[model samples]
Target: MTCLTDGEPSATADTDTDTDTEGELLLRVLTAFLREDVSGWRTRSTPVRRGDGLWLRLPVATRERSRGAALLMPVLDDGYQSTYAARLPLLRREPGGAEFVDTAGVLAALRDLADPVDRGGFEAFAVECQQELDALRLHAGTRREVESLLSERYGVDPGSWTGLAGGLGYDTLAARADHPVYPTSRGRSGLGIAQLRSYAPEFHPTFALRQLALPREAVTVGGGTESWLSPRAAGAPALEGSHLVLPVHPLTADGPLRDALRTAGLEGRAYLVDCPGPDVVPTLSMRTVALASDPTRHLKLPLATATLGLRNRRTIKPGTLTDGAAGQRLVEAVVDREPRFRGVILHADETRFAHAGHELIAVLLRRYPAGLEDAVVVPMAALMCPAPGGDRLLIDHLADRFHDGDTLALLDATLALLFDWQTTLFAHGIALESHQQNISLVLDHPAGGGGSGGGAGRTRLRLLFKDNDGPRVNLARLRDVMGQQAPARTEFDDRRIFVDGDRPVLDVFTTITLHLCAGSYAFGLARHGHAPLERLLRLVRERLAEAVERLGTAPGEPGALLRAHVLDAPELPVKAMVTAGTLLSKERSGAADINKHYTTGPNYLRHDHPRQNYPRRNYTRPTGTS
Candidate 1:
């Protein structure tokens, strides 16, 4: 036996809010999608004619609100038939930049400014709201009542959202919308979020939805190629656009989640990666794949050769990457260049990655992979996860101990494998939607991959990774991707999004610990601890020092990139970062926010090579069910 697993749980602290590495990264990318003019909030004495209808961006808020909080506030009026509210919270700013709710006070102020006609419209709208509520056939009362109605009214599913809403005692929907103490672009939209959360939800046509909300026009009756969880069912119909998969519940709090799930958990990957596929986007591909075998088989292609976001759905949606020729073009580009870049894992088909630069990103990766990369290719259609093994709870292999060392060594190997798979996203302007289920564990014999000396020289062995099909990388997470600026490296900033929360240095640390260290733990803590943060930092320090010594002061992007690695020492200046880890052996429940993303254990093993015979998670959903 390599090493015994560490059943001990880590200690944790109350963090009303934990820093979201990916959310910060995405802030940079989202800006490109839509820009908000801060000037809109100010009273322009000139009051130049604004957009014809009151331009509504965000709801009026003042307090901290959770799912369905919008329903609580009275919809106020402006001069236009439609009221105008900007996305920005109306009143005060919340800490951590949560979206502030536009409060009644803000509405009153807007109402006062509006021409009487618009004000009348607001009043009329408010009146209609009551009628709408009275007619709610599913209104059972309490937050739970509202939640039930949501599932009934809208085919939403229950997952981690349930736990979140459950924590709030939100059986009834709030009458008003509260201001986001800190608005999260990373958060879900309107009732869509609530529906998945506390209750079944309904969408008022007027409510503007954000990313991840179920689209009004998604779903097809028997049109999509459906398979069944049971043998008897055929493809009944596929929900149009991105269908709801399991709540990307992952192991958020390392200490507790790990103990509960008994897997190292995918929390680190969750914060470190964005999903890699495009969301409800259009694929301009010209290739015409057979509707039936086309999508399924296409999805099976090697990661280096396919677009992950675009699934073979019975129906299609806008903003989602399309399946066919255009995607083929991008896929072909990356595949062709694989050798040039040493090795590459390409994920383009998933709907979540719509905004990740399609071809351009491919080109950029083609360049970098050629320069620096320890490559491995996993052709798996597993559940969404970050760490490599989370795709499968490959327990079968864990029991087999054919070698020496310990589980810690096995875990390190596991992490290195997952990191490489996930890092591909950053190369392509995408993020790995690495929750737990997304990874898989595999057994690899070094000789099987092509012989003893592994890595770039040979296949080394197969490591687990999900086949492309999960959430797309939110283009918005560029901020977190470009952690701490590299003083001397201009190249480091080339792909970096300066705005939002882009911080590449921190991202690296997250990747190594969460993804790498977790794998180590699986084998046992002993082997994994060898590559402790201090040791890793030392390695980086040595690399940087050597580079500077030889080059006599680094220059440009190369210098910056190197500087970022050194600066991204596991020990960062942020107090929030200091608390990333908790004490070991503490028995506790995982945090409400982070608990859902726990990775399954079987997919990886500490010190164990990737397991081979353990590929599964490729189960096609049963037909006729949401």
Candidate 2:
């Protein structure tokens, strides 16, 4: 049963509201500032005598504005400050009064708090934040209308949609959700309001894919795509002499790709096709889209937009296609060898595609395996989004279908599957960037073959993973498992993918999987009163302990290090997403890769407090395993 009452509000209410931008933005910035302990916030800030919850007065050195203080709610698994503490004012200390501050004021205070001030970075970040707020406000009304429509169409009668269509529908809902940590995630730099509606998934726009014809000798081709680019397909234009067809995103065809052709002196040789290709709709990733006629075939094209940060452009770099395919091959080999992972782990066939060896011009086709028309696939990010009308979460619908509305049980089952797969991969020396957006949960039709949505209670859970370009690999450990002669390989064009130490592996596991995927849910559920934060965190630890026992926690083993780093450590690593993703340059941030910078945060799994002394279990190998 769902723990929330009919009148109760959703955990995401603060972030989803049409107005109240200031309050939501304040919470987002404050949570990041405090959780990251930016400029020694934890050590320097003093606690206030608040009656309801913990509040702190931050010492921001600013002459233009008054001092600011924030109210924080601590999560139990990781010390991430809660982002849903709504109606809590960021108080400004004035001579005769204290009043709430605007979002700009709050950001300005935060900018002042930084040591060796980064005025330029903070100013740019502020601009993005305003852009994000505008976009969020612009989307607010349309988002509700879309959610209502989806609820009426699918939520009431899910059987109407096939599994793939339903998955894309859920992806549209997920597109409305914000990133857990990044405050300016909604900021799509270089995109105007019209472009947002035209190209963004949240708008649910369906437009025809554009095409360009390049010289046959000037392009690089990967897998076979003759059928996709043939003259007879989708009324494609007849190719000129010695030319190959290239599918391009509508946004890129007229913008950066056109510029790229001119820069490469191929404008005369290569020309844009006047006729449109197949109709396609954007997915959660924005750049990747599925065909309107055949949902199974997806095209991942390079778009000329920036999300997350100005520096993070959505373009495919040279060699990215081959490297992504290689990563997929490595993971597929591991799954084939491990009996527990055989049927439950799935991959999209990304071996077919072509690019012009430029970031601005490329396309990768991802083909889903056949026979998914009768399953329910939901992205992990969509699970927590408020269902239509904001009464309960979308996960409640699944809970009602499978667990008799037992949301806690659904969460438990999900956590079990996640830890089992993640820790097993860790043991095998692979660290997937399994963020909520990249991974989706596929619920198979119940035994006896019923409709995709309405089925028996007992359905199988499988994970569908895509975007294989970001996983980190411990090459030496993988060699031990696959043997030196095995064809499985982790070699990629990106140097950051290979790591020789346990720290990098642990960093990815804890930050992406544990914090973003698991902890985000736990904290969200607790905020909605589904379960206590401690109880949910205990469930996570228990599941992790079980995985550790199965992997065998002997000294110098993977499990031993995993256990020590995740469970027994005093602090866990958290990605400084705002810092590295947007705020600072590589020189200023001192980060080699923009995505890899981290800061140590308090570990909630450890119980060193005087009141609590949870017993640690002795981990040993399970019999007949390994």
Candidate 3:
């Protein structure tokens, strides 16, 4: 096994193969359909008797359509047939009933669906989806290999290593990056398999960053204090003169940016000077790389990869860089002022820069919290990831702390922290897109011991948020809270800080945090038989209600509006990626408005029964042989 440390580069080896096979393409489409909820399919189960043993048979279904083309007609009606047609075999019709289908019968049915005449204009989308799916599967295989290799190299059982190794963070992050719960784009990365292995965090790939030293006047720097950049300059002596050193991703050095660097009057033939410090590895967010020497400082470099259903170029919009800086300052101020919010830390983007007309070179700098070294920070998405060498979920590792492996206890601790964070942000009129990737849980084990022992006492779980660019602030609330402390620029045009309407601003936070973050986790846990979906939803409602009651104390408090919206509103705004993709397909000009696409759906919190009706149950061990 290859042993690579942070700030050290591994020799590149070619492992490329043709990934665009028919079976692989079909799997990708099936995964995406299951993940994005494109046709509103739900997993339903029926009891079946087989030879004297009774079994619960679960099948995927949609309203009015259960099997055959009928089951997929709704998706086709939505103009996604081209994207889904290749994967139809995966949903084979049952012998007698049209409802239950054979999900495992995909390979045999691959050739059954030839180029159908009905798929007229969507042929291109279908092709792209298939290609992307194939690429995704290839990456998934690489991820599995990386995990297995890391487990073996460390001489620890897969998924059981609890030490705070620098490599462990990237290993777990890479494992979580697979986003196993959602089938869509499973393991599908924007970079190819070989590039993924070389540069992606999952593969534990590390390489020295190529540096570009440009005259200070050639680039525009914004949003950072002079002290922040001073430390960064110490590592690069090439920038000794008044030049600023910018780190470039290794892949970017070999790609389109090469020409741009040459034009900018760089020395080397490759147009990038090799920086001498430690190599950095990419995180779950492909663009953000953490230093091997110092885990606290993370450098966000520009990599044009189409992952998570969006193509990110790492470039900040015209004035948004300054806006991000101001937002960070405001959040810091709020955190300092509010005691309840002090637990949550927003990893602000301290600095942002772009070379003149070279937005591709833009980078954002962020620092992890100081004095929290022992804490194990895991992305929320990784909690449900399958543990290596065991059927249990990765989150199950924390179960030793709870009574009788009661996962609900863990859920409660996480929710309590999330409530404090969310409520504080809401009260301040700031909405964060706290999805699984953007949010991390800092699990502070008890002081005296480690792992299970750490859980014996109260385990403190706090929320740490990154990517400060997306938070939407309400100008009205800012003025009320900050008073004279508000930035002077806010007086001229509130548009810089505040979004247009109150509801939209609130929607950005609620939809992503509540629906995408909590909702997705509930479904994932239920899928793995760890906990019932309703149980988790009920817990969420209870926590929200408690928060509402506590915040409702002061008259004119924003909590009242939030309370009503969460409890009484019939539907909650959901960012529907498939619906958004369809809308983007219709546009003939300019870049797609990927962020604006939203669809309202039934709120899970609103229930007909009184809150007390669903009494909390004791932490009984899950059913099966003890």
Candidate 4:
């Protein structure tokens, strides 16, 4: 059923003796078998041999222009013989063994490398055209039609308060005319409300939410645009939401997060916010709806993990795409492109809070349920997934987030943790793309743990990673619809409607990663680049003897440490945003007092780019879905 390999399979010459980084060797090996250019390509190898000398194989979807990429899955022993007899190949082999194509063919052979030795004491060896029953039975339903049915089954107005339009079955990422964010009785339409404060500077966000602030005026910015923000938990002094823009360096004692919280008077009561509106009054504080719960709250992402096979890459609509492949590109920026990076952790059910105004900072997660520090990872589920579009970062190292081990230290100390993080991530074979916007750095009193006392009340890093919404499950999956093994299937490949290039990886990352990582890297270059980048470069230095230092220290799972930095948010202009902003300001001040405006600290930039026309669709054949 695959659209690849017409008629009899084509042949290729044997060319395997190449000396290079495992990355290169793997690519050549993968290429020989895959037999076509791959997109969202990823490579992983053991830092050193372990256990029965086995290497874990992982992959995401295949977004390439040719062939269908599927996570060539792993199967052991004679089990695959039957699958292959039915034409399923596990493409695998020994460390110094032969290779071939077809998922089953490749993986089955690779697993055999770990097989037990013969009675003579040498590794068992032999290749057999083992065949099994010609009938394994095909499923009754066509996989592609499932999404169509799910969308129809749900129907609009299935109406749970939690339900909202996120393009699940709409066939487009950004809304279209019939789609309902805005009703046009007009020519050009805007998706979000323009900031009312831009015009009505005196307006304040409001709603009865206790411990919150609201714009005073009833004016709505940009048509019906509404934004929400939460003040820091440590407390603020101001008691009014006076259209104020506090300086990051602060010209006064009270800081923004604290000031915003105080002005909103949220220190006292709890308020519920489940309103209806194009502009329901703003709720500038945590809601009684509950913040972090005793039970971990979770938010599933719109992104799917790395999948294989060429997804329907024909640009079908006008908004940024939000499938697993797009997410994989984001992840690659974080895991493969140098410095290590991990993604954000959503509150048990806090996917909504992660992206709402003021709720985006990692500092907010500092309010985790009391005893959950040691329980670093939490899975919170919700109706909507909120991973910012693209890999671009908009960091908010809130001024209130400046204590000892707080956000500040997490930034500086990011270097010391990359070793375990990068290796763990490559193992997953897909990056988590845990950029700052998606994650939080919580600071609390140390009931116990190392440097517990010193970082107490400041910040003791417990790096968190989540968001299955946008995963590049594994490299193999990117080549084809990785069957049913993907970590999570997407609600829809709605984001593809917006991707513009022949390959989704380049376009998505160019926009998202450039935006996010540019800022982070700039922060580092401005702050401490040598350390973070070197963390990886050093691990991968001259002879890699560096890994020898800690023979047994790799984290159990890839992305285990999930440190979100340049490697984690590479598409970002990690070094550029900081650079551009600096360039702009220098010109503004004529370079007279440049140092006054610039700093090693990452300045938060959170501008929400609205959705536009669905780029023209560029269709290839209907290969298969990832």
Q: Write the per-residue lDDT of candidate 2 for residues 176-216, one digit (tens) a residue.
A: 77777776676677766666677788777789888788777
Would you estimate the TM-scores of all the predictions?
0.28, 0.87, 0.73, 0.27
User: Could you report the Cα RMSD, in angstroms, for every candidate shown?
Assistant: 22.4, 8.1, 8.8, 26.5
Best candidate, lDDT-wise? 2
Query: In candidate 4, residue 22 scores what lDDT?
Result: 19
Off by over 4 Å in 2: 1-19, 48-78, 81-87, 91-100, 112-117, 151-161, 224-226, 231-237, 449-457, 485-490, 607-626
Q: How would you order the candidates by lDDT, starting with the best?
A: 2, 3, 1, 4
lDDT of each: 0.24, 0.70, 0.53, 0.24
**lDDT for model 4, on a 0 to 1 scale?**
0.24
Best-to-worst TM-score order: 2, 3, 1, 4
What's the distance in Å from true for residue 452, model 2? 7.5
lDDT of 3 by residue, 26-61 (tens): 444454443334333323333345453333333433
What local lDDT score does residue 369 receive in model 3, on the 0 to 100 scale? 64
Worst window of 10 by summed lDDT in candidate 2: 617-626
- Tens digits of per-residue lDDT for model 1, 369-451: 12112222221211111111122111211212212323333444444554443343333333333433234333333444453
Error of 1 at 432 (Å): 3.8
Instruction: Please list the residue runs of candidate 1 whose C-alpha ends up more than 4 Å from where it truly belongs after superposition.
Output: 1-336, 340-403, 406-437, 446-459, 463-554, 565-626
Winner on lDDT between 1 and 3 is 3
